[model samples]
Target: MSFCSFFGGEVYKDHFKPGVYVCSKCDHQLFTSRSKYEHSSPWPAFTETIREDSVSKHQERPGAFKVQCGKCGNGLGHEFVNDGPARGSSRF
Candidate 1:
């Protein structure tokens, strides 16, 4: 599968330069390049957020959380614990 299907962006197996990333649906700044990191998974990963309220998390299923755009409530991805390159939890 293409990585774009996961994050709505062409997946490059490299870190993105420091910049702003917005929600595809609402154009709200949901993540910053500084927070992004390369993961072995299909989609990119983020270790942190630019702001505390940049995104919203919802429990999609048991033991899994669905991340969404805070402004427009567009589904972004899922949150996984201990699934990052540095052993940090990440948003996939």
Candidate 2:
């Protein structure tokens, strides 16, 4: 069974929801809709995107964190700040 992710509107209904958003390219479960504090960011505003093992951080754009699929190494998206709750929680 093949499964798509939230990227490009290709997500499987059975696994799509607010819990742990996994990557289609990678079977890594990250982020959730609930973690999204409903703010406006250039990209998807996620309070957190899974634990440390689910993501890979690479240097890009001089000094930036690049999010890549842990399984297939697909470029899912980039993460940003200045939004969500001010609780200063770990985004892992």
Candidate 3:
């Protein structure tokens, strides 16, 4: 999906089940319901991952980073600094 469409909060707006979210390409577990919480952002936000190695981060540019599946290198989302629950950060 395009970045705007993916982040437009339309994909998982109704997904409230407590389960692990995985990469669609490789089934690599990325985030879990426990770390999820509501935010004003268009996309779903997670405070943490299932594990430290669950996803990989790449510097897209200065002060910007992109998140990808650690196992298959698929783009998952972007990371941003904010007053989120996870030590003042959040991932989308």
Candidate 4:
């Protein structure tokens, strides 16, 4: 299946309703749509995760982080510190 089939329409342009979002391949619950927010970026954004271990984070470099599905290792997106809706905050 394509990435958008599980994630939604286009990344940032798609507005997901409040619900639970899971991995398309494994059905592992990854995020809740309620946490989804609009940041004017080119992908869907979330304020937080449904659980502490629902997702995984990888540090690509000294200060860069890549967020992905914990169960299937699907590339969800990235996390940026102090670059969200609020200053000095983080979003995925």
Question: Lowest lDDT 10-mer window, candidate 3?
Answer: 1-10
Candidates sorted by lDDT, best first: 3, 4, 1, 2
* lDDT, candidate 1, 16-63, per-residue tens: 666777776667776677777866776667776567677788787765
Q: What lDDT tens digits, residue by residue, belong to model 4 across residues 1-83?
A: 12234334564337566677776667778767777777677666777777878779988865458988788888777777666
lDDT of 2 by residue, 1-88 (tens): 1333345663333343555566665566766656655343334456566566666767556434677766777675554333236654
Q: Give the TM-score of candidate 4.
A: 0.75
**Minimal lDDT window, size 10, model 4:** 1-10
The estimated TM-scores of all candidates read 0.74, 0.58, 0.76, 0.75
lDDT of prediction 1: 0.66
Winning candidate number (lDDT)? 3
lDDT of 3 at 24: 69
Q: lDDT per prediction?
A: 0.66, 0.53, 0.72, 0.69
Best by TM-score: 3
The candidate, 1 or 2, that scores higher on lDDT is 1
Query: Which residue ranges in model 1 land beyond 4 Å of their true spot?
Result: 1-15
Better of 1 and 3 by TM-score: 3
Error of 4 at 20 (Å): 1.2
TM-score between candidate 3 and the true structure: 0.76
Clash number by candidate, in order? 0, 1, 0, 1
**Candidate 3's residue-wise lDDT over 1-92, tens digit each?**
11123643567644567888888678888888877787777676777888889889988865456998889888877877565766757555
